[model samples]
Target: MKMVLFLTVSFIIIGFVVVVSMKGKMERKLAFIQENADNHKNATTPIILWIVGTTFWGLVSMALIIGMFFMN
Candidate 1:
């Protein structure tokens, strides 16, 4: 309906703006990464750990929310 169309249009517009604005910065960042490959090697484990922990916490929070809704 109208809500879906609004969300679709908003998503497309925001995505287009973000991409257009960041295209140059993205290319620059990629070039920097390609030039300095060793600097980011140590971050993989920590990033993975953070993602896993965050996912677990998010699921737990979502379950709690659902439980509360059902309990009420």
Candidate 2:
């Protein structure tokens, strides 16, 4: 039970960090693209990264919730 709690908290913290980092990264990329007219093609990478990061976070959260339910 303690291990499960530790893992859940760790993953949540990691997910939060990933989200904040990705948001900053995406903003920087977008700003760069805005400053340069020809860099529009690179915009998809940041968007994809943001989507993947959020999706992974959501999945982990759901999995943890389910695991906790079953543990009881």
Candidate 3:
């Protein structure tokens, strides 16, 4: 149970950080692209991928925590 709790917390924290950092980077990239006249097509794929990955981790973490609670 302890191990599960630790892993859940770790994953949630890491996922949150990744999501936040990627969002910031995406915002900056969009701003830069707006300022310049460069093609911004397909530029959001990486950000979308990161968000999806982070969301998966977050969901797994939540499920683990919930499972642990039910087990206890």
Count clashing residue pairs per candidate. 0, 0, 0
Q: Lowest summed lDDT over 10 consecutive residues: which window, candidate 2?
A: 37-46
Off by over 4 Å in 2: 34-38
TM-scores for all candidates?
0.45, 0.74, 0.69
Clashes of 2: 0
Using TM-score as the measure, what is the rank order of every candidate, best first? Answer: 2, 3, 1
lDDT of 2 by residue, 1-72 (tens): 989989998998888887887788787877787788585886667678788879988898989978998998
lDDT of 3 by residue, 1-72 (tens): 788788778878877787787788878876776777467766767767776787787788778778887978
Worst 10 residues of 3 by lDDT: 33-42
Q: Residue 41 in candidate 1 has what lDDT?
A: 68
> Compared to the true structure, candidate 1 yields what TM-score?
0.45
Error in Å for residue 51 of model 2: 1.7
Which candidate wins on TM-score? Answer: 2
Candidate 1 vs 2: which has more TM-score? 2
Give residue 4's error in model 3 in angstroms. 1.4
* Ranking 2 against 3 by TM-score, winner: 2
State which candidate, 1 or 3, has the greater lDDT. 3
